[model samples]
Target: MTAPTPDTASLTSWVGDAVLAPSVHNAQPWLFRYERASGTLTLRADPARTMPHADPSGRGLHLGCGAALFNLRVAAADEGWEARVAARPDPADPALLARVSFVPGPDRDTLADLRPAVPRRHTSREPFGDEPVEEALLDGLRGAALAEGARLDFADDWRVRELLSALWDAGHAEELAPEVRAEIARWTAGVDDTATEGIPSYALGPRRYDGRAPVRDFPGAQRERDTAAVYESRPCLAVLGTHRDRPEDWLLAGQAMQRVLLQATLDGLSTSLSSQALEWPELRWLVRDPRSETAYPQIVIRVGYGPEIPATPRRPVDSVLTVE
Candidate 1:
């Protein structure tokens, strides 16, 4: 018997799932095109959505698109299609981030397990409980990153403090810069529900009343009295890194990140991510531990059991995907 393959409808649904992957400031800077004749899906970066101030090198853009690629793979696996991805297949077309060709394989079940998490995984910005993540669960997260060609290192108390300080310093520095502030303003939709892309005010969680939680404070975020919540004092911070810093490395780190995030979700944990310190080259270098083999720190993640937060807005799949 011949096995089934995805049609245009299946590809469209998968692209919808792909866009759900989180992007910096919810900018959602990615595009997808499926070639029917070749049975290949191509991922591209949207130049109009690039963040010039925060992600000048396009590292964050690559990471976001990589995450979307991971989700697309998971979605395809759920439909029994094995996705083989080639990153930066064309040197001449740098914006063409990845090309994925699918085949039938037995391993589809493994990646398909994560399909349910695709919709449930949202960036929780509210305060988390004091419950410590179990060692076994942390170990699984470490393995998830490793499978995707990246590293996840849980910071010790002293290192967590250092990361906190770096985040604070970077946040203050970004606030002071007009260009950075302008970029934030452009991506954050304060109370505008009609906007398709950008961080909605409702998803901002709350203004951190106290504690060292790494929630970003978008300018003009709604600050009602009820919106101010106290965050966990001793937050569990982890640094996701790679051995080298390059566009391909960034993409790998992003896939690792989404894999970790999905696994953590399954473990019944809430999570949030911050790249404040990583936005600046000077601060980024300080994020990695001296003893760790991680050569470049890509993103900082906060994990715990926190209150349920709303999912941010994403552009319609039709707007971002082209079927040929």
Candidate 2:
């Protein structure tokens, strides 16, 4: 496929669709610069958006940016152009994670189908109904993960519960660490409308003892003091994994995370993500099922039927996209 002619206007539209991707705390830790002369789009990480406490290594930030990158690929394909992508194209430029050159290719898929679910997918921290996700739907989710070079494992046994509990314990250990705790507090702006990034108060949901693995509450005392509506119970949980642990693997995992979430949204499923366990190195190892030797755990996703939470606000496209 030959590279497409540069079009500044069309590139801007593609960047707009790309930013609609979900990020941890809605940090949207990505910046795009498109060169009209070469039809190249550069993806860079915004260090300012990094979560110092919660994501010290910038793993979450990279993951968020990678998710946006995946969206960019889909968006370009939908625009009848093929995106030839290279991760970290320049060795000296650590911030520049990817460069995508547009080219002419078969326009078989429309990201417009995924577009509708872009805004529709929200982190449903609330509980889910007792019903199980259909096997076919689960398979579809697995396929979505594989397409991005990752794996998804569904946990449905007592042994899996034991492993999850251990990992959750390890995550709690990290949360208690002073440095990690400080970072989390710094990035987690309280439930206020004024804040641009971080988890919001309204989205926090109610805190109740469900006698099961629970989503981490970003809001500490403030959340406990407030009386919010009760969430459902017994939401389905799936673990996302990758075979190798590398920078590129992490990026691919992020893309798979967003793809699976968007697919779930399209399938009329509410989803939430818990990386607390995966955040702690000690706990991350425990999350890996003994049965799976080839794959390493990435993120834990909760899926089920639930109420449609309010959409989280995003920064304007002009702030993140630069056209030249």
Candidate 3:
């Protein structure tokens, strides 16, 4: 028997591409259901993989699911299928995050152009170079985010310093909170970790010796190998936002976040994510630029030219996907 191509809209193949999407703590908190009869895919938040304490509100989980949804759309388009996504189709079932149907067509948003970056994109925790992100690329990123129903605002110099200070406060506060600390400890892997999930030590990149690059300190307190390096003095930072703060908003922000990231990868830029400040209620509220109309900040992104980092592990498609 020959294997089906991705254009066939094979559940297994679409899930294969979807699993590569980034999630909080590598939690990959999502499950997919494909109906062969109607050629539709349903995305749901997998409670088993959700964080109770750190993400009691389930915002992080929603973001992870949304990222997967974005990947599924891109994969479908690149494979000659048009994907129409209906978010939260069932109002009562909040866990029913999104429903996507595959239609035969050669036209969709040219976002399929970023299909290659879907696999190449990784969250680089290493230090970025001093070179600034070009304005042309920045415009493209902004457009990508806007195309996905979200806002990406590049902070001004003063705003960057302010964001850095807030992130420092959030990280310090996380250290003092036993539950949050334990959450990170549980989600992060060690030097010799062999598990298929969670962030492994090898993908932790390096410790931030200097510079305010908001790479989440996945190491917790355990001593790791010496790989400290001073990050860039003035790292480029941007905030992904939505006009509202709700479960659906977070989900949309996640899709927008991945779109911008993929565009960055295509533009030859490495990226990292920092939601530390956004995890704290007060801090998350302040992370958004006061001048902007975007009231809610979902995630902070560090974009710049840097060395390519290794890919993180993801759960097997068979583990998170079901087709009937």
Candidate 4:
């Protein structure tokens, strides 16, 4: 029996699922072009929305797009299509990130279990409980990252402390720089809930009472809050790295990140990202494992049970998706 070809309607649905993937500062810097006849979806970088200050080399942009690509693949599988992706297939068009071509494969069921986590996975900035993540679950997260051509390393007690210090130092540096603060301001929205993109002030989570958690300090504009909440004393931090630091490598790291995030969600874990230390070129080099500083650290993750986070906004599919 011949399998049915996916139409524009189905592709839109897949893109809808794909947009739910996380991006840095909610700066969803990606565009999707789907060709119905060839059943291929092309992912491109939205140059206009690139973060110049935080990600000068566009590493974060690629990572976030890579995450969206992973979601697209998972969504396609749920809709009964096998997605085969090729990175930067055309040299003439470097802006073209990846081209995912789909075909029918009965094995699509293998990833159907993860489809549920797509909606539930979020970046929770609040304090987490004392529950320790099991080694078995950590192993699954490593496997998930491996499946997408990236690495996830769990930081030891000492390493977590070092990372915390680095994050604190970097956050301080960011706070001091007017340009850096202004750069983030460009991507941060107020708590009014009118904007479709950027991190809203309400989703900033609770203010740090103990000053230990590695959450970013973007409370929108000049708003000041005296509110304070208890954060985890010893947070479980993990480093996501890639062997190469090229644009292509960043994209894979992003996919690996989302894969691990979804897996953690299924294991009943809440996750938040802390790339403050990784944003600065000087501090970013120190973020890797002391043993293997060669591995480029892409993002820092805080994992454990935490307060549920409200979903951040994303541009509608019609705005970011194009049909050909």
Candidate 5:
């Protein structure tokens, strides 16, 4: 069924689709409020969803909400409406992440095609095929990030590889700390049916000893069996960054991330993200390209052709949306 045409109902439907956007550890850290009288949709971050230990400054929260905002825009376009978005419009209210107003515009089916991938796009932690991504497809993904005010840097040099590895080493070291481990444990719910969010045991991949590469192990604490198999080599790594390292910059990066991911989905690519390296302050600077000026790295996205993985579960729409 199509989304309702009335602004309120339409936005409600759009928000439902938007929530399907990925978040760190499936936190789903967002709230949507639709003003029927004004026809404005406001996206807010739920402070409770903030990962205080891993994401102390709420940067990841902004990224997650920003991804949801991007999906909302695409969903709006698919429904034949223009999404006029303002990121962090009010300085006084930090939680007011973005405001989207619907306007009549030319019909664009590009986003309509993306609608199908919204449900299909997933974080595939399994091994990808050795087949490299086409240069043209990579260009499309780059352009998608640029359009959202973010830059995509493909790591190809040995120095860059060393830097990323060093950062990952440092970040992983930090994660191993007793205090940090306790904090993460608090947020990460054990295999319980009542839990609505956080990474589940089923999503965890295997731990392989490949000195050249590393993958985040979600079920490391629970000793769950790894359902994912290993590929021959690591997939192409692309880092998303912004000129500035502010809250607004992070929001932009999040939107760009989802755009690139959805575009990858359209190109029949499987993807996963590795932000563990960028989570730590000391290691964050290491992830940035030395040649590129001071741009903060937001995420490390791994992309390549591979088998479609299972989608993660999300909370119901009624749980995240407020009608008033």
Candidate 6:
């Protein structure tokens, strides 16, 4: 007998969950097209949302789309469908990221377990408690990344210091670049409750007054009412990486990134991501620990206990998804 296929409504609902995936600056640079006839959902990169200055090579764009693809898989599993995904299905079409075909199947408990965290996982920019994360939980996070064919290494004290210094240098470089500043301003400008995308003022957290927090300073992110607080003195930082650096590797890293983040959320940890150093080619190399085997540092993750922050805005499903 032929397997059951997901309807348009089901696909649309899955896409709803998919958009919640984190992106660079919350740009959400992805598009989804669902074909009812074939029960397939196509993930595409939206060129219009590309950040030329900060992400000229489109690595960030691919990572964001990859994250959205991972969410779709989780959504499918939660809804009792198996999502058969093909990354870079079309060799000729660079914009086409992945194609997922859904069929009725038993729920994947592993992925369904993370569905609850989909909505709850937001970047916490506030100060995190000094309490250390348990070793067991940290091990689970490592497993989560490995399961997705990526590696997550917790930075040692010396490496953490080097990463912070690289970030400081990258941040200073970003401030001096007019084009990069303009891009930051474009996304963060006049963000309000009604806004569908970009980092809102309330979610930007306060400017760093006196801490080595690896938070990206969005232009004009702070308001007069906000006050800076001391972030965790010793942040629990991890480097998510892949063995090879390629478009496929980026997608894999992104899936691993979301899986790690969601698992952290379920483990009662506040999390934030920093790509400031990775945005700079030289600093990106500097941030990687020479002693470690993992290559191509994709993202720097901050994991600890902190206050829950509000979710960043996302474009409505209708705005980013199309059904046929």
TM-score top scorer: 6
Model 5 ranges off by over 4 Å: 1-6, 157-160, 187-189, 192-195, 209-211, 223-229
Q: Report lDDT (Cα) of residue 165, candidate 6.
A: 92
**Per-residue error (Å), model 5, residue 226:** 4.5
Greater-lDDT candidate between 2 and 4: 4
The global C-alpha lDDT for each of the candidates, from Candidate 1 onward, is: 0.88, 0.75, 0.83, 0.84, 0.77, 0.87
* Candidate 4 Cα errors over 4 Å, as ranges: 1-4, 189-191, 219-226, 292-294
The estimated TM-scores of all candidates read 0.96, 0.91, 0.94, 0.94, 0.90, 0.97
lDDT digits (tens) for residues 127-161 of candidate 4? 89877889999999989988887888898888988
Badly placed stretches (over 4 Å) of model 2 are 1-3, 110-112, 211-213, 219-221, 228-233
lDDT at 108 for candidate 6? 61
lDDT string for model 2 (11-115, tens) is 787787778777877777888998877878899998787776667666777778878877777777776777777887888988888888877758476444676
- The parts of candidate 1 lying over 4 Å away from their true place are 1-5, 223-226
Better of 5 and 6 by TM-score: 6
Candidate 6 C-alpha error for residue 317, in Å: 0.5
What candidate 3 gets wrong by more than 4 Å, as runs, is 1-9, 107-109, 191-193, 219-224
Give the Cα error of residue 49 in candidate 6, in Å. 0.6
- Alpha carbon lDDT of residue 36, candidate 2? 79
Q: Of models 3 and 5, which has the larger lDDT? A: 3
Q: Write the per-residue lDDT of candidate 5 for residues 1-324, one digit (tens) a residue.
A: 433334666777888889988888888999888777667778888878877777888888888888888888888888888787898999999889988877775767466667877888998766677777899999999998988889888777564476557656865686577665665655454844455676665555555444234466542345256344556364588788899988888888999999999999988998888777777887777777777543788988888887766677788888888876
lDDT by residue for model 6 (1-324), tens: 665779888888889999999999889999888887777788989888999999987888887887888888898899888888898888899888888887676846578889999999998888888898999999999999999998898988888898899999998999899899889887786778788888888887876777666877777565424677788888899999888998878988899999999999999999999988999998899877776678788999999999877788889999999988
Best by lDDT: 1
Q: What is the lDDT of candidate 5?
A: 0.77
